[model samples]
Target: MRATAEQLRALRQEVAGLERWQAETTPRRMPLGHAEADAALGGGLEVGRLHEVFAGHGADAASATGFAAMLAARLGGSLVWLRQEQVGREGGALHAPGLSEIGFDPARLVLGLLPDPLTVLAAAGEAARCPGVGVVLVELWRMPRPLDLTATRRLALAAETSGVSVLLLRVEAQAQASAAQTRWQVHSLASVPLEANAPGHPALSVELTRQRSGPPGGPWQMEWDRDRGIFRAWDGGGAALSGPQLPLAAHG
Candidate 1:
């Protein structure tokens, strides 16, 4: 027999309670599919935390942005990217077509061009609290003094409370103190050469500069495989160089 309204309500409550319990008990780290990188990242980058990526020079800004995009793609959800107007103008606006060529899905992206740091932070905080956003990326060419510990702490709390990942992209910024769970320094590396000496997958020389939970360690040479949507160790002289590189001139 079909259940009465009261019985159906009770069953719904039970299901909701079970889901909440599972979320609380399950491990939050989502693996990047690279064994070594995942191991160094404490089983993978943890969700609900603020992570920082620093670019040492103006040239490395592209590498940093690419790395952050790959991470957001790995998280497998819609992304919200916030950038101050000045940074956007200086670093070049994030081009959708260019980003898609690098493996980021343009359809899942939302861009916010704010006028100032405070506005950017405010937008990021609100976006982080939104359950629909999978990842929130905030770009800061220089971390303003106003974005002190309290501000970062607020960002961290928002991410944690909503179970979203936050990436802070700092271009040409000094490594100062912050409340980020982990900090990375990224630099562009020569991409693997494909058949006919073509440029292959994008590569980055990533160094783990800081970690709040464990000892930070890495100078890992990593590559992003757009086909597989995961990171892999840069194979120096092996199958990585044997195949033809994927073309970016066109896409489905």
Candidate 2:
């Protein structure tokens, strides 16, 4: 049966109203590690969705880990770091101080170097469904073929419903297209002086390679101070502290 013009118009209005309601109710903003990145990200990383950071092969894992830890820490919740390969042997364990400086409780953070990517994804989906977890970071070299868009969309929806943030950290060269909301490429920037004239530690330079909802190709830089176990922004003026200024939570 063909619908009349008035009926079609009414349906369109109803759909528009529903979209507006969803937009108003959805939690759409998160604090990115860097202010510039946040601006480029259209706010910050959107909560309740999957964001991908693709640090290409030969990319510095320390910097990538530090960046992820810093962001996760600010979000203030339990974090699960899933590694695709063995951590102790293949690469060094993720730097604990890097996360600590960002204010993540060591006890709340769970690190797992899984043998299978599917297992990690499954765990992330479950975590997203649960309210206990605040964020889940999955570090994988690649995604198995069978776990495609359907699987990812399921996770995304779960995150939305449960208010969890899922971050997928892929090795620089290996991160191919996926159903992620935002994708980034991170590189290590040269260290600067901690104080005026005093030498400072190195930091990470991140670029927003792709984003579903915002502009791409941002040269956002953030520094990880090993001694302090914290992350700060790197402005050309100096290594001044920038980004979200939330209080650091005490670690257990």
Candidate 3:
């Protein structure tokens, strides 16, 4: 027999209660491959959450994008990346070979080049809801009005329902109120040169600026390990790179 309207309403209420319980009691953190960062994060970044990364400056756009892309890569699944067309023109498009260097499969990527922030935000919301999509990365040059708190809240909700991680890459933007689980800023650091003056591995100075679930901590020097597809602490010389080598190219 079909259930009565009252019974259906009660069932919906029960399901909502269960979802709340699970959210409160369970935190599925994926270790980010850095001990200090993991400790500050209370283990690691939570899966199925919204994370934001900002460029330390316009010149750091490459590092910021690379940081977000690396996180999406670590998430491990089909990646849907949405960005404004202008971003590609200004900060360099997502290059296939560059991605390959970092262990991200180009075949698993779905790239969307939209005309404006509104379009990108709309696409990002939908992508976050898609099943089988491992990660949704939305790159915005600056904080646009269309990507307000309400928009992020929707994205966060979609991520929670679909169990997909959403990465927001903000270049030349300031931090604002949002529903992001964690917020970070990345700046390129001159890598320690390898044998015979070969440029060092991709090194970056990263800071965990904010978070909703754990104490904010960081400002760590990190190196991207392409072979392992993870961020490792960089201890080259035990000091931040200096002089002309401090500035890295915009790709990585």
**Model number with the top TM-score:** 3
TM-score of every prediction relative to native: 0.82, 0.74, 0.87
Would you list the C-alpha lDDT of every candidate in the order shown?
Answer: 0.84, 0.69, 0.88
* Candidate 2 accuracy as lDDT: 0.69
lDDT of 1 by residue, 1-252 (tens): 599999989867865865685467653897877777688888998886799999867899999999999989888789999998777567787899987987888999999999888899999999988878899999887758767777787787677767789999988789877889889999988888866878879988888888887888888889898888888888755555456555777656
lDDT for residue 141 in candidate 1, whole number 0-100: 79
lDDT of 2 by residue, 11-59 (tens): 6786586557567795668765466677777767788778777664455
Give the candidate order by descending TM-score.
Answer: 3, 1, 2
Where's the lowest-lDDT run of ten residues in candidate 2?
Answer: 236-245
Model 3: residue 145 alpha-carbon error in angstroms? 0.9
Q: Please tell me which model should have the higher TM-score, number 2 or number 3.
A: 3
At residue 144, candidate 2 shows an lDDT of: 64
Q: How do the candidates rank by lDDT, highest first?
A: 3, 1, 2
The TM-score obtained by model 1 is 0.82
